[model samples]
Target: MAISYDNTGRGIKVLVNGVHMKTIPVLLLEAFKNHHGKIAFDKKRRITPEERKLLHSYLVYLKWIRKLRKTEKHLYQLIKDTYPVATRKVITLDSERFELVLDNNLKIKCPEKIYLLFTEKPVIIHSNY
Candidate 1:
């Protein structure tokens, strides 16, 4: 499966065998599944030290934002300004969710359509240039 984020940041374009499959919302999603499955993504690109440092900082920033939302309203406002987060996007699967390999040694839960597209055959995931 090839996943590409829309250039306008509207949604995620999912492709199967070079054909359009579905477009999902742009979300920070986490996938959970109990069943073992095949993964086609490359796992050889280890995160560099600098990238690890940046990732750590990003996690800390998210933690701070969560804390600020509860404890410091003014500070949160100053931080987020007018950028209100959109409503959460949820995916419900009848069977166990599938494991989706992502960059930076990450894995996410995706619906069956997306999962089958990726696991049924090898695919080259592309980025929007």
Candidate 2:
């Protein structure tokens, strides 16, 4: 796990397995503030190649804009607010597949990369209230 501020000083670069995955902007870190406790990931087992790619794309979309799209925001809120009354609480977007487990903390646990990126240090939240 290697995360470093790029020489350009615009954002941080995340490298998984020594391969460049995403260069998350400084603003993106701030945008992640809302997801701190509401979302998490369980890395109890190995992450498959396809799952890694899926998570990579997801993060790309998440950091692309300052605010999350309404649909995306609603989706995550549902994951956070709902209880997993079923045996397996897995969620898949289109053809991509992944798993989500609502832990005792009530945080939705998905893939590790998403968890780590959002939980990265210096997550400053700017708000009026």
Candidate 3:
């Protein structure tokens, strides 16, 4: 994995590794998706020519934004208050596809580039209220 950061660049790192396109592991993908942020891809993975091009496009996009995880305080309330009315837990939506698991489902859809924007952050979350 290679991380590139310049003296004047924002406090972000870009990791470039081979791309591998496969169905993300369910549990890990679930937890990763739960966040309101973007992650970047930096590890080596075997991928087809088409997938490699797409993945490369996503990586280039990452160098421009300050991607952050979704803050529950910022997005959850909106989901809770607006969801039951518009969409429900059964609804699964991705930027490219929408799977309605229930009525009035209108879940937010984000692109995969978000995941590739952050590949080094810890996968665990700690909370206290």
Candidate 4:
């Protein structure tokens, strides 16, 4: 399924046995079903100011997370190629989170999107390759 956010044919594109049958995200269906077993979108010519604000906030958050994940995956892949291997885990505290991939001689810590606000610290280690 192709999940394209903010597109007309957006949501999870589903294929049944390798044939495109539905073009909606399956997870979206699950979300709607979980909330009330139905899809609830505020449909109106002009949304209320507050509603628009909330919608904007959600979309912005999604974009921020998507970009952050891309950055993280790229970095992780790079490190994985150079390093022997690592046990990966996520640590979340309050509004912040980080990924820790531990090898016998090293611990790789990658911060989340919110980590940019603080003073980031860099730790160097010697690796015998």
| Per-candidate local distance difference test | 0.39, 0.39, 0.32, 0.38
Residue-level lDDT of model 1, residues 8-112, one tens digit each, is 376444444565544433432111011001212233233334433333433444555577789888656655422211111223443233544543334444344
Candidate 2 lDDT score relative to the true structure: 0.39
Model 2 weakest 10-residue run by lDDT:
32-41
Among the numbered candidates, top lDDT falls to 2
Q: What local lDDT does model 4 show for residue 32?
A: 24
Point out the worst 10-residue segment of candidate 1 by lDDT.
28-37
Per-residue error (Å), model 2, residue 73: 27
Candidate 2 lDDT, 4-107, residue by residue in tens: 33434865554445655455455544333333232222332233444444445444535432143443566565553333321222334433322333344353
TM agreement with the true structure for every prediction: 0.31, 0.22, 0.19, 0.26
The local lDDT score (0 to 100) that residue 21 gets in candidate 4 is: 39
* Runs of candidate 3 exceeding 4 Å displacement: 1-45, 67-129
Order of models, best lDDT first: 2, 1, 4, 3
lDDT of 4: 0.38
How many clashes show up per model?
1, 0, 14, 3
Error of 1 at 13 (Å): 17
For each candidate, C-alpha RMSD in Å?
19.1, 14.9, 15.3, 13.3
Candidate 1, superposed: residue stretches over 4 Å from native: 1-44, 81-129
Query: lDDT score, residue 80, model 3?
Result: 40
**Where in model 2 is the C-alpha error above 4 Å?**
1-7, 30-102, 105-129
